[model samples]
Target: MNKKPDYLAHAVLLLGMLLFIFPIWVTFAGATQSAGAINRGDISLLPNLSHLGIFVRAFSFGSGLTGSAPVWHMLLVSFGMAMTIAVGKIVISALSAFAIAFFRFPFRMAAFWLIFITLMLPIVVRIIPTYSVMSDLHLINTFPGLTLPLIASATATLLFRQIYLAVPDELVEAAKLDGAGPMRFFWDVLLPVSRANVAALFVIEFVYGWNQYLWPLLITTKGNMDTVVFGIVQMITGDQLIPWNLVMATTILALLPPVIVVVAMQRWFVAGLTEVDK
Candidate 1:
């Protein structure tokens, strides 16, 4: 017998999608309108194509009156920070998980538990101490200071540990019998098998870094080092009249990188989260 269509499910999904897309559409439309109109709460649902050049202007000079760094520069800083944090977390977490899962060592489980216990400690609890340490190292206002501290993630380590644990013992035995050393096995066997999980984590960690406000706010004292999220806030909180059009345009631009990453890695992300055969 043929299966019936799930109309109710489709309708609910469509409603949810519309709910998400509505605000984004409004923002895009507002970006194409005049600042005064948006300020007067006169945003239109449809964008004015004639005003499309506003994006270029926004990208080149975001709220120029505030002496803010250009949108492009802020975006570049965020992208670099996000990439560094994501890759650093993956590499460090993977090695840590590998050691914990496969190797015999002193206090290995204890070490893993200690790392895992950090998950219970909110980042706020560590900020003052972390800042003091960064200050002592003379790393404040530096790019490394902005990213290095955020790289060690208990969640990523836990996820990686789970993935490593799921690897069949037969595979490890076969690799050993084939004379594959630890590093060789990690590079040749483990890395390839873990590709999907890596992609998923990259997406998560990249977005997390991109949207960071509090830590970047503390670490980056200079305007030039500001992330896009920080720049948006600066634009809004300036002393002069708010430029709603520019703000909306910058918001749209800030959203693109994460969207592109998710779209590009959609297949791998889904596989990593849902695949059972692995």
Candidate 2:
């Protein structure tokens, strides 16, 4: 006989999903309403479909609250930075982990431990010195400056190292017997095996870079280089009246890219997190 469904678990999951989604629904509803209505506490559960053009307006013209740059530009900057940081972190971490896992080098464990130690000291702790270094390198007010400092990921390195270590020694011996060199083996075998983990890490790191506010704030001095998060903050904190509708619309737009990434990579991301073996 077939087992019955777990009603309690289903109910709990539905509740949790609604709890998470309700705020987004409210935001979207508010976004489609008038600023006057939202400011006057006339928020509604149902969105006004006629006002859907607000999203287009917000993306094209911005809120005009603080003479901020256009939303499209801000979005482009954020997207580029997020992509660069994610890919950079993955490549560097994968290489470093591969070296530490497969090759016996001088002070190898010491190097791995050093990378791991940096995880405890997050960006906030080293912001000052990091800024100084970036300034010294003459990378201020640039995209490279915005993304470079955030690229190194000790956590990714550690995860990749563990994955590499889990590879069977017999496989390594077989590769050796096949005359596969280091780079050859890494390209042919290790990378394919680590694909899921890479996808999961990319999602995580992309969100991390996309949501970055403080570092971008410090590094970028030009309005043209401002990220979407920074522009959103600027829209809120200005001396002029806050356009709640426009702000809400912009917020909704800002949420799209990362959501698309997560949804698009959902399968690989889930597999990466849950799968035990390559």
Candidate 3:
């Protein structure tokens, strides 16, 4: 038998990687050029070293003639919202999954299925009713309001449930033998064991919450509450001579934190996704 590598497969993957990296390269190059150079079509694929000030301004102040809050504030709100959503989903989903996985109760399957159904429903589908509920609860312009409605998710719960189910019942038995109650077992054993999974899921859920636009725009009427993702876009959407270089600089700033997070947690994240406890 002859063994040969698929050169075509490698070529295709190489093409895909280039396709992904191309835009990022272009954005970085654009950030270094002046707005006049970009508008005049004098832009080059190679990044110029002359325009570091664009970044400083982008980091130091809000965009333009309007008295919008600073970019730093927008970034702070974005990080705060992302952290809240990631942690919120993990806690709620863990408790819900723990109950569904270990307990024998009436309507247990029904409850699990209900949560699973939420995965089928897109946030846009329920936006109006969700907004109505938020309004009734007077949660608008609040951090909880920005995050809580979006936390109506089932993915993390489902992931946690799978991990819990795969854990040996012997651990529960051992805990019981050791006179550990449910809460104690959870705090002492289950949570510690699930740390990798939680870290993995945090990276994902944080990105999801950070990238949210529509719901945040709808609920956040105040300029100060605008997230970096939305605020940066709002800078260039009008019929004005927008500062393209500054816009690109803000884009780079917006992408950095999440990229840093993914890079930092990559080892644990890969493990969490791949490993199934026995």
Best by the lDDT measure: 2
Clashes of each: 0, 0, 0
Expressed as tens digits, the lDDT of each residue in 171-219 for candidate 1 is 9999999999999999999889889989999999999999999999898
Q: CA lDDT, every prediction? A: 0.91, 0.92, 0.87
Model 2 agreement with the true structure over 128-180: per-residue lDDT tens digits = 99999999999999889999988999999999999999899999999999999
Off by over 4 Å in 1: 63-67, 276-278
**TM-scores, one per candidate:** 0.96, 0.95, 0.93
lDDT of 3 at 172: 89
Clashing pairs in 1: none
Residue-level lDDT for 109 in candidate 1? 93
Ranking by lDDT: 2, 1, 3
Residue-wise C-alpha lDDT for candidate 3, range 52-104, written one tens digit per residue: 67788888656553657788899999999999988888999999999999899
Candidate 1: TM-score?
0.96
Cand. 3 TM to true fold: 0.93
lDDT of 1: 0.91
Per-residue lDDT value at 12 in model 3:
100
Query: Which stretch of 10 consecutive residues in model 1 shows the poorest summed lDDT?
Result: 60-69
